[model samples]
Target: MITVTLDALDLSALLCSRVCHDVISPVGAIVNGLEVLEDENDAGMRDFAIDLIRKSARQASARLQFARIAFGAAGSVGATIDLADAEGVARGLFGDEKTKLTWSAPRALFPKNKVKLLLNLVIIAVTAIPRGGVIDVAVTGEAEAPVFVLTCKGSHARIPAHVEALMAGTPESGTVDAHGVQPYYAGLVARAAGMQVGFAIDGDTVTIRAEPAAV
Candidate 1:
């Protein structure tokens, strides 16, 4: 008899895909805003529109840069990155938005791949709370292993069920939206990287933890 076991490694990839899925909307919004701002008329309206474009663009860029490390792909081996750079990516994403962010991580604990996945999920969680909320992110890993813990809380928890299901690796075709797409892509990436993804809901909040698997 053979039994299959899905570990944290699998979860990481799944969550990475989920991260990609969720980011498209806001990213697209940034693109649209840019197009509108190009020929924007009216000084007052243009200023207002510029501010909106800047904020959205910042958010999109932050999410994409972070996701590249988290969901899309990994960086070069032993590539040393500035501590402030990592935090800056997160700050750019978490700041100037309705969501509040709190982060804690040791120096160079995660590889580029892990960092990207973690940051991607951070943006996803923060966005889940549109009206304003709090997001907590922590990084932990070493030569033996590494992991990330992400928690997002808000007054109204409106995370779609399909998104949660995607995180769990059970996605449906009809409900496959941007949010679910990220998880689906993440699942693929995680499999390639040998990692796992885990997700749970707490009251009105959701938490996801991802880690690499042992060979």
Candidate 2:
């Protein structure tokens, strides 16, 4: 059996779609807030509108910052980033979502590839639990081959079908859409880092790992 993959352009398209999908909600909330403030004469309601705008603005900014670092070429070549920064971004991305994050990494800088892989793995894990749950991320091993383990658990924790297909290098369809591109990108990034990826799933728990610590 053969799986469908995304080409460069298709991948680009899907990434764009995903970014837009995430950014739209917060931005739309800001607009709604503005409308509420304009139409509401009650002081309390106006205050509520203001709060909504503030929260939505912050969330929008957080998501954008996370996406910039996670999805874009925001860092210099061969640069290492602070793990705290990644954790903060992850927290911001899950704002108001039912998911919780537990990070078990060092405070030191991590190679850009490893940082990216960690974030992508977070995305995959977060998306796996639609009913909300906990995400535990850890990093260890030699710097040359840092190993990462991501565990996702919740009431309905499970890997996405698209991710499974991409991981196996054989998607069920010919084109990789936005909803299925993160896993594909994660695998690609893992390989580029001179690492291998593996996963295990048991009932409500799913684990993903990257080996040979990326440089």
- Per-model TM-score on C-alpha atoms: 0.64, 0.91
- The parts of candidate 1 lying over 4 Å away from their true place are 1-60, 71-74, 77-84, 127-130, 158-160, 174-179, 212-215
Output the worst ten-in-a-row residue range by lDDT, candidate 2.
Answer: 167-176
What are the per-residue Cα lDDT tens digits for candidate 2 across 50-83?
9999999999999898988788876788887788
- Compared with the true structure, all predictions reach lDDT values of 0.63, 0.82
Looking at candidate 1, the ten consecutive residues that score lowest on lDDT are: 1-10
lDDT of 1 at 160: 43
TM-score of 1: 0.64
Provide the clash count, candidate 2: 4
After superposition on all CA atoms, what RMSD does each candidate show versus the true structure? 6.1, 2.3
How accurate locally is residue 125 in candidate 1, as Cα lDDT from 0 to 100? 73
Top lDDT model: 2
lDDT of 1 at 82: 46
